[model samples]
Target: MKLPDPPLNQASEIAGDWPLHGLAEDMRPALAQALARGAAGLATIISLGEGGPRPVGAQMVFGMESRAGFLSGGCIEADVEAHARACMADGRPRRLVYGEGSPWPDIRLLCGARIEILVERLASDDDAARALLALAEAREPAAWISDGERRLCAPASDPAPTWPGAFSRRFDPPPRLVVFGGDPTALAVASLGAQSGFSTTLVRPKGPIAPPPLAGVAYRRDDVAGAVAAVGLDAWTAVAVCGHDEEVDHEALLAALPSAASYVGLLGARRRLGARLDRLRAAGVAETDLQKLRAPIGLDLGGKAPFEVAVAIIGEIMASRHGQPALARRPVSTPDGDGQAAKPPGGGKS
Candidate 1:
């Protein structure tokens, strides 16, 4: 099993929102190390994926003959590093689809979740630093992110703007999860939120009560639209209706749908879920968007309490973010002597 986190620094927690892949503002070190990848004049494309153990923008670097990203998990990095080196030398952007089995018959990843990563080699750094820095400074509305072979135009709009031309890797801006309501469950839910690697703003009628003494929690109580505007919601945010009250949760969910949050979850039992769904359907939330709200708000991990329930909810959040089935499971086991776990089934790389 992956070890429990030592305890996140309040100032440096990660997120678990959509665009999933686990990212933390604290990832500065990994990113800094990654920048040195290729060491030459190669730009970078850090493919963000929801399904992987890493954060969505958990960046790995591949330029010409070098790599710096953690290989999926420890089990997979060496091979990834070797191939990344070769790939950088090949002089062309690559869309490597790896999962199930191994790059070779001898190697393997226990879990078989196929990942499509777009690896591009470009002469960059000054350019990326410029664009990213501008975004950080709140200058430049948006910029066209180019990785030599392709151009991903990120307009200042929600969902930003990305061209899904095949790629093995790319970076994703953080996904926002705006929560409303402040109750006992509020802090626990927010606690779960912290682990998600998302930029969460705790919004209550007043503000975050006591600011919740939990790791990775941020408190910001503002009007819904104002909050979204301030935090900048986008396609990746998954708004959860955990604030308990119907009026507040309803308003918040409705407000978020117009923005780009990909998922909306409601915390309630069957009767409540049905009632809320019926009301939302009547409210013209667009069947697609309305359908996005997970009325039941969690997987059935058999936890009756709110905190336990929060865990289940986080599970569902993970599944939704990764675009996996509502019940995809990855059972872990120790690796064998040869470094191969129970091998998953898949043909060699296509």
Candidate 2:
């Protein structure tokens, strides 16, 4: 199915309220509401140019009364919302563009980049949409494809089907964070992890200690070693052992090291980590596997507070997830001929 060419003169007004950054999982509630009301539209970024505010596959769901997710750095959402409303009215998908030389003269994307967005009418009962939602809800990886007229959803492990003039987007399950501890520090890590889009699970080893409040986290109670196995670590999972107990830390490390988890971090001092590693080696864990643990985990942010420590740990996890170096390097300023430091160009945050 072919999409209708967008009208060159079509323009949209500004929407005052911008939505928050979120993934497909976070937008499920809004999508469900939209579907129930029979007035929902989905806008997806199918293509993006260099320096675009948002990457390809970024999406937003719009309901008659509310919207969830974001498409850009707060520049084109209003216009996108207008296009989405139009799609809901006509039930026809259309491609919209913003930024340099855009057809919509009223919208000027300040990011100095271009993006192609596809807006389509959506319903709760849509077979393809429901399939995609189910995969996301289950934290399963999948790929979704659409040709504006037709949509297809496939498991990530399956070969993608080809469709001429279609755009495809891969959706991975949200990164899973397994925090082993019931302490305040572990609670902080889980809380921040949840807000940062991780499917956080707080695992407390069986004990007299009470569990932390689980407003946005999954609570698991098991022996430290058993909890690791119960969580079923995957390549997208990160394990953080924050308990100060030597035995608990050692057991958690043993389970995490041999798993497919991309990151395994333990909170402790250098000497403590050394003792733990020795214990692991004596317990039959291979030296090579023991080396995989990030003992005294987190970058050296130098803050001693629990929240600060959580920030460092989360930051390190993100860097590791993206294959980034352990240490962040700041741009070095060069001296100009006049003996003044030359400032970097376009220095503001993106």
Candidate 3:
């Protein structure tokens, strides 16, 4: 069965002022009342002139009772409430940004991302309201909410014919992980990938067979593009090469590297996988494209066994899934005269 979709929320940084949980709670009754009357309730969000502190998939839902979709840890809800109340009072649409790189400690946390948030006054006919209605009616993840500058849109399996909302964010299909090989380590890694909320395909090269813990998994054939064909793989997906067969690993790498999967990893130590990369590149993979592959996958957890190794690998995948900053992976550089040197970030940087 498919996984339940995550709720949608608008970015606070896009709307100048962060949304207040208390304000949404307070606003709920009025909005709910509007919904009760069968009238349309529209909500619009955009990046503030700068940015807000929220993840890409954050959301805000305005029901009759003013429910908060996903919010910042409720740190600055008071200010957000005041902003919401003022917007309701003034009957106007406005733009605001928390930080412009100045020293506003509250707004400008050094998170490395810029934010811009927009809160526009919406009536029944507003596009955002209509699109939101579509999502609400069908429980569709098709609505991609954007703050104008940076948008987050996820596709829906069954979307309504027309999206009556006025929001434009690049709609991205949900991310998936394509796991190759049918060994215990591969299964363990796939199991952890499922836990991290990725669509996984367990490829058994020998033929069709079932694994033990068949929960939250979608097995696939070992042929080329099997995972890609089974479930759509965009730049968000991560492909990992595990299992003992070098032949199987090579085929999986050949299939995955060129695709749009965001992260490509091969489960092996440095020396072994490094040779594979060299061969793939020598076989015509570009230098830049070759850089995208993550060999010696996972963090250096000092792990030594299958489960321990799986743990480290999963940690890396988790970091990649959420776009988390990668930890340093130590590397050794060979000098021109055959000398070697230690590089920055360490071996686990990939």
Best by TM-score: 2
- Model 3 stretches with alpha carbons more than 4 Å out: 1-57, 60-171, 321-350
Q: What local distance difference test score does each model get?
A: 0.51, 0.73, 0.52
Candidate 1 residue runs with Cα over 4 Å from true position: 1-69, 72-125, 132-168, 208-210, 281-284, 326-350
Q: Is candidate 2 or candidate 3 better by lDDT?
A: 2
TM-score-superior candidate, 1 or 2: 2
lDDT by residue for model 3 over 1-350, one digit each (tens)?
11211112233343554544423211223443455544322233333233455643343433333545333444333334444444444544334344443233355335444433344444444454455445533334454554322333344554423333334443333456777766667777788777655667777666556554657777776464564576655666788777567767777777677777777777765555557777787777766666667666656666545566667777777676667755534332221223222221113212
Q: For candidate 1, write residues 1-350 as lDDT tens digits.
A: 11111111221112332322223433333334445553322222244334566543344554443334453654344444444454456645544444542243233334545444444443346455445534534423344454446554343543544455422223355555666657655566677777766667677755644676667666766666676667666766667667756676777877776667777666655434556666766887776676455545566565556587667666677787778874643311111123221222110111
Alpha-carbon error at 18 in model 1, in Å?
Answer: 28
As for candidate 2, its clashing pairs are: none
lDDT by residue for model 2 (214-328), tens = 6678877778766776678888899988875767777888889888888888777543445567678888987667666765677667675778878988998989888886453
